[model samples]
Target: MTPTPADKPPSQALFSTIAARYDRCNHLFSLGIDRYWRKQLAQTLVLKADDAVLDICCGTGDMALSVLIHTPVHCVWGIDCSETMIQLAQEKRIRRAGRGRLRGKTLRLSVQDAAALAFEPGMFAAVTCAFGLRNIPDRARVLAAVFRVLAPGGQVGICEFSLPRFGLLRSVYWAYLSRVMPMAGRVVIGDAEPLRYLARSIDHWHKTVRLEEELAGAGFVDCHCRLLTGGIVTLTVARKPGPLAAQPFL
Candidate 1:
């Protein structure tokens, strides 16, 4: 059932309406560079056996799967509120059985909320959320929840859209996002408001420095930012305090 905007909860409706087109629309809006970001994240993340990682807002589980493929982590836990998204991810996981790569890694998929995670405290060695932090309505709560669930020294890596570094390019990108993205979205997936909401989130998001401050405020240590796609996107990495995370805990 495709939900109209009038549905009881609009965000859920919006996500449900677009699940089928979500991946394609992402590729379109990102100009196909988003895949590269995921690959880079997977490569950069250091993982080890007995490391249990959580992936919040794990839509379609692409980044989680990328992590699974790239590292020898003991397990990957993916949670998303969108049932359709989980279904798609599950299907993909099943299809990839032929690859015989995940035989030893446990990949758990569940429909769960980001702001209020169900996992036990100190459960994960690291957490990753790709293009997910913006969609969470309670950013602080989600960060706190993530902090709580992570083991001491657990790290988090977030990949998300950001304002470009250069003023002229930022202006051009913002204009295109605000003006043309919705139109193209309408043609591509029959949904414009969601894309517009995405644009607004990016437009109004805190700068990278402020984001790093927010992470630090949430008790993460040594927070830093890395610009990607010429600063059209940013990857913020932070770690929970303590020594276990000095190296991936086996």
Candidate 2:
């Protein structure tokens, strides 16, 4: 139980160590409901052809693939902090191309930190992060980064695990997230540490209202959330307003 400077586990090292088994453990921990969650997120964004989308913390590119499958988006870029995860994503890209699933167009995956995005302003039409925000300690910085890279009126969609809103559901969710998830990680991934971090991070996450307020404060407008599966997870969507010229102060 080592702590980092940010009062969280060293996510970079932890994710690097567990990159190979990350997806497997996700399936086990969520009882495979993660797929449905990702689908809902992709659907909410309403991606279109010729649209540019950025998937931050895009481990193994599942959400990106979901976009490709559901939307006729011209380009999809997936980025993560872990190089190993990027490698796997690239390998999958290659396989997808070989199978004639993706041709002519390019699918890109790279190692990039969300808090310091390496892109020009308004580069993407939409942005997404799935099950990744909690791992980031400086949430506000990342949200600011998201705002900077997004074009005015670009949409942002985020899906994350949350404690259930109902009492009975919260108890069941906690037991599965805390105890069963770690055990499944040990049995399936052969690494229990990352799962422990995943659980602890969610347990200590800022409340939903606080997060919504933070997004609004960071320049996201029309922010709204839909709690899924009895609030075990929440998907929030917001749009960056058109260029903010000087306005009279109240």
Candidate 3:
């Protein structure tokens, strides 16, 4: 646990309140596409057998688990500011541990803020965040923090929702958000406020180009953004310059 969160921010705290049902709601709303987005995001990591990974705002460890299963990484650390979320992660981690799915790789959990990590400089080989950046207000700070802990040559994969912009899809998406989504959330989770925030965040979030610029400004080189599922979701991958990049470009 590195410089962990003593106080949960309001948005994260709201996540805590819904932690028990959060995963279910997400899967339902995304029609299970969230799983595919997470898989694609996890595939962006530059993992080595001896490399360690950090998943900030890991929520329920979905992406972190993906990293573990998708690559032969040395270990994984999944952190979040919401205790309830972390608690759920712990349970899942324990179950996976007993099932041998961990493959002898370490998976640690911490209740830490994404903007303020506890690990030392260049402590991780890679870092990834999925669907969590939209909830974070200080995304720049979190990016900087990710840059700090990631080793040179390490990569960061960020998967986030963006508002739809295409013609008919945009209209249908907005209508779903305004009407069907809230009704689904309320019916399934007894709350629609969180879903509302999720929609609003996407509506106001930085578009792909702006997000890439922000990542580059934070010292992440080789930044790239890929749109998925009709541009409603974006997967951004950036590399931290390191020994390989400096070795006299062949």
Candidate 4:
């Protein structure tokens, strides 16, 4: 059975405690490779002019902003369970707007649980989540919510950490995850518990979860995964059944 929110206080509290230092720790821990991963996920969306995109678990709006900057999407909506994360995302939107980087595109962010999206059905052309799904105890429910909100033929791109298939690489990556990452998190965030949880969650997901299969079960077709950075990360892309409407913008 899927766990309730009450049963998952650690995950939400972890994010809240580290929200301010989240972006810094992310970049530092990943050696700045996460930016490229987000860009890769954004490119897979193939967003078109006037296409609306929804970003689930969009902490600090990085993934959503990447989509807006990299694609010609009309609007991007981001939702996160952590209010502090959502506030930081809003601050980022305001700063980007002040710098004229938004190009008049709309950016909306709110504190909403991924398992229960509040948006209308078939409201989005594409959906994205980066480094977030594994934290949710009920990822299947979140995928269902994503499937419901996406239009027919809408695409979904998910970026997640995974163990490398190559034995040596996997060992090395595991060491870094188990040791160096949490150590760096201690220095960056002043707490190692969240980073430790991150490592454990990634390990658990890599060993047991089949995201592509889950996507298919959630009514998505053409589900596939592409490993990046020596399989340290996986980008899973899937499409809803039916005619795809958005053409790539020139």
What Cα-based lDDT does every candidate model obtain? 0.80, 0.80, 0.79, 0.84
Q: Lowest summed lDDT over 10 consecutive residues: which window, candidate 3?
A: 1-10
How displaced is residue 28 in candidate 2, in Å?
A: 2.1
Query: How many residue pairs clash in all the candidates, one count each?
Result: 0, 0, 1, 0
lDDT string for model 3 (1-250, tens) is 1112322224656888899998898888899999888878776665677888899989988989988887777588999998999999999887888455566877899999889999999998888899887767677999999999988888888898876668899779877875689788889989887766665556666432377888888988877777888887888888889864221110
Off by over 4 Å in 4: 1-9, 98-101, 246-250
Better of 1 and 4 by lDDT: 4
Model 2 C-alpha lDDT per residue in residues 1-250, reported as the tens digit of each score: 2333344646576777787877777787677988999988888886568889999999888888877766677688899999989998888787787344455556788899999999999999889999888777688999999999988888889998788878998888888877887787788878676777777777767342367888998988878888899988888888899853211111
Residue 154's lDDT within candidate 4 is: 88
Candidate 1 at 12: error in angstroms?
1.8
What's the CA error at residue 224 for candidate 2, in Å? 0.5
TM-score attained by model 2: 0.89
Return the TM-score for each candidate structure. 0.88, 0.89, 0.89, 0.92
Residue-wise C-alpha lDDT for candidate 1, range 1-250, written one tens digit per residue: 1223322223766777788888899888888888888767766666677889899988888889878877787589999999999998898888775376677666799999888999999998889999888766567899999999988888888888888879899888878888899999999998687777777667656432377878988889877777887788888878889885544211
Query: In candidate 4, where is summed lDDT lowest over 10 consecutive residues?
Result: 1-10
Greater TM-score among 1 and 4 belongs to: 4
Window of ten residues with lowest summed lDDT in model 2:
241-250
Q: Which stretches of candidate 3 lie over 4 Å from their true place?
A: 1-10, 98-101, 206-209, 245-250
Query: Which candidate gets the maximum TM-score versus the true structure?
Result: 4
- Give the 10-residue window scoring lowest on summed lDDT in candidate 1: 1-10
Residue range 144-196, candidate 4, lDDT tens digits: 99999999988889999888999998888888887888897788878887777
